[model samples]
Target: MSSLKFYNEEGAGQQNSDLYHYSQAVVLGDIVKCSGQGGWDPTGKLDANDVEGQVDLAFQNVNRVLQAAGLRGWEDVYSVRSYHVDMDASFEFVVDRFKKHCPDHRPIWTCIGVTRLGLPEMLIEIEVEAYAKKA
Candidate 1:
């Protein structure tokens, strides 16, 4: 049996966990599931006007958690869930980001539209799950 473990790296990852009371990612067996990551930068800055940049930054944050476990980055990821404040407004940016990130193949993905996110300036949040292939 595999024990449950929490993953929280240094810098912004640790800060977010301390303030929010949640791990950046959780691991059980061979699966690593990350929390929803918003568009804010490492300095906690969010740009409301840049949808594409925000969405891309969200994925970057997701990758940070996955990489913390020494995984194969986004390539090891098999599932993704994104929350958007406005799907219609951010559809193109989201899809464009997917294409750029997963150019070789597509993973299981779900995009949800919500009224708001953790931060008012945050327009997109992304969550990802990766396989560790541990024995």
Candidate 2:
């Protein structure tokens, strides 16, 4: 089996720092595992206090990571897991946002309510897994 490669693109990848202990997107053979993406801006700061803005930012973060791995948008995502601090607002925001961003290709998704995240101001975080087409 081939080893995985991680990327720490710093602001380029929308991550705060370019020094991730691990790779941003690990490519193990044909599968790519992306890290949890939050509602942080390109500077790594949370954008808004509300669920709608936060959810949009989270998807933007995920899009950047996926692009870094040379893949398309949500269509490349095989599975997704979202962590929300407030279920009612955050869940609805995510569902609506997903419907708009990923209308046709519905990937497997899981939404979980959490007490807290890495940052206190962060309201939502999303992680994704994608499969690369065979070469």
- Best candidate according to TM-score: 1
11-76 in candidate 2: lDDT tens per residue? 735344444444557776677788888887777767556778889988987877877787775778
User: For model 1, how does the per-residue alpha-carbon lDDT over 1-135 read when each residue is reduced to its tens digit?
Assistant: 247788876767788889889998888778898898888787668999888778877888888888887677788889999999989888888888888878888989998999999988989999988899874
Clash numbers, per candidate: 0, 2
Identify the runs in model 2 with alpha carbons over 4 angstroms from their true place: 9-20
Local distance difference test scores for all models: 0.84, 0.78
Candidate 1 — which pairs collide? Answer: none
The TM-scores of all predictions, comma-separated, are: 0.91, 0.87
Instruction: Give, for candidate 1, the lowest lDDT window spanning 10 residues.
Output: 1-10
Which candidate achieves the best lDDT against the true structure?
Answer: 1
Residue 90 displacement in candidate 2 (angstroms): 0.8
